[model samples]
Target chain A: DVKVTQSSRYLVKRTGEKVFLECVQDMDHENMFWYRQDPGLGLRLIYFSYDVKMKEKGDIPEGYSVSREKKERFSLILESASTNQTSMYLCASSHPSDRTYEQYFGPGTRLTVT
Target chain B: EDQVTQSPEALRLQEGESSSLNCSYTVSGLRGLFWYRQDPGKGPEFLFTLYSAGEEKEKERLKATLTKKESFLHITAPKPEDSATYLCAPHEDTGRRALTFGSGTRLQVQP
Candidate 1:
């Protein structure tokens, strides 16, 4: 079974503070993604990494940045946390050749920016 | 633009009731459709993946079927544990690995 683990289950940060959310996967998948889930907006992609040091912006990447220094780890960074940034953040990983393109997800981190 | 839409924002069902959830997409050159179940305050759990029209997959009491433009998740004799939000995402062959997800259908099963 594949396992994806996040650094935190819940976090609280003050406005303008820097925040980091870490994710690690044991499946050695080549693709990793960061998404934020809101009530009506669904799961909107924030950023994704296809390989080490390779990153791509998704639909809503303006306030977020990601790092993929290693294959097993992906980190999401918030330059300046704001109340609007509070949401459930999810991390997922998938292998390119998995035909199904099924992404295994972590438990998610609920960040609260106050 | 690619889009995925789910119908019946919420559904309430009695235990042992049978129903289906719908997911429609407008992505061109469809690659795959994925179904996931999510409980409150947690990430989604993958359920099934449909690759092409006429394809079907099942697990226990849940069955997923795909057509050219939409997919259906049919639940049979659901139990209270079956209550969760069902999400669908459609992947397009646009050389991007990201999937556009639907808002999701929230299901509640009362015992």
Candidate 2:
């Protein structure tokens, strides 16, 4: 089974605090992604990395940054956490040649910014 | 830009009832289409992956079929435990691995 592990399942922080959400995948997939899901808006992409240390901004990257220092790990950082950033954060990974476009996801981290 | 839309923003059905969820899309070149089932507060779980027009795939009571411009996930005799949010996405024309997702359909199967 493809396993994608997130560092935390839930977190709460104060406004303007810097936060980090970490994820690790064991499948060695080349593509890793971070998305935040909210009511009405659904799942909006924040960022994605195709390889180690390479990242691209998705539709909603503002106030968010990502780091991929190792092939198996990807981290999503909130420069300054705000109440608006409270939502379910999901991490996904997929192989480069996966024509099926199938992405395996972690359980997700629910963040609550006060 | 690739566009994917799912119909019936929400649905409710009795256990053992059968129904279908529709996904309409517009893209530059068809690469692949995906169906995912997401439970509340959890990440979406992969259900089926369909690649070309006229292709279909199935698992248990769920069957996914694709056409030139749309895809359908048919659920048969569903159970209360089968309730979930169904998501559809299109593999973009960009060689890069990025997917554009729909808002999703929230399904409730009551016993």
Candidate 3:
């Protein structure tokens, strides 16, 4: 079975502190994505990587960065955590082909910036 | 810009009741439409993938159908376990691998 695992299910950080959320996929998918899910905003993409060391900014990329140093791992970095950044962060992985357009997601990390 | 919209933000049904969730999208060209089920506090799980109009796919109590402008996720004889937030996402031909998602339809099935 395809599996996506996140580094944490819940995280709390202080204002102005750096935060990191990690995601790993066992399916060896070529594409990885980071998204922030709000109550009414749905899932807004923050960043995505189609290959190692390659990243693209999504619609809401401000205040966030991503790292894809390895094929199976992707990370989302918050430069300075603020109250506005408190939201559910999700990580997903999928193949780059149209045949595998369905992305598999991790359980998610609920981050709280206090 | 590609956009996805889901209707009836929330739905309530009793056991064995049937209902349908709607997802409408506007894109340059449709590549695929996806359905996902998300439980509270968890991530979305893949349900169906529709590639073209008139395409249909089924899994147990759930059926998904697509048309030129929208897609429907029909739930039949839903049980309490069927309660979840149904999400729809569309992939366009813009060479981007990311999907544009709708806000989602929250379904509640009570016994």
Q: In candidate 2, how many clashes are counted?
A: 0
Q: What share of the true interface contacts does candidate 3 keep?
A: 0.69
Model 2 misplaced stretches (Cα beyond 4 Å): none
DockQ of each: 0.75, 0.67, 0.75
Residues A60-95, candidate 1: write the lDDT tens digits: 998888999999999999999999999999999888
Better by DockQ, candidate 2 or 1 = 1
What lDDT tens digits, residue by residue, belong to model 2 across residues B85-107?
99998776676456778889899
Query: Which ranges in model 3 have alpha carbons more than 4 Å from their true place?
Result: none
lDDT of 2 by residue, A12-85 (tens): 99999999999999998998999999887777889988899999988899999999999999999999999999
What i-RMS does each candidate reach, in Å?
A: 1.1, 1.4, 1.2
Provide the overall lDDT of each model, using Cα atoms, as 2-decimal numbers: 0.92, 0.90, 0.92
**Residue-level error in angstroms, candidate 1, position B56:** 0.8
Q: Is candidate 1 or candidate 2 better by lDDT?
A: 1
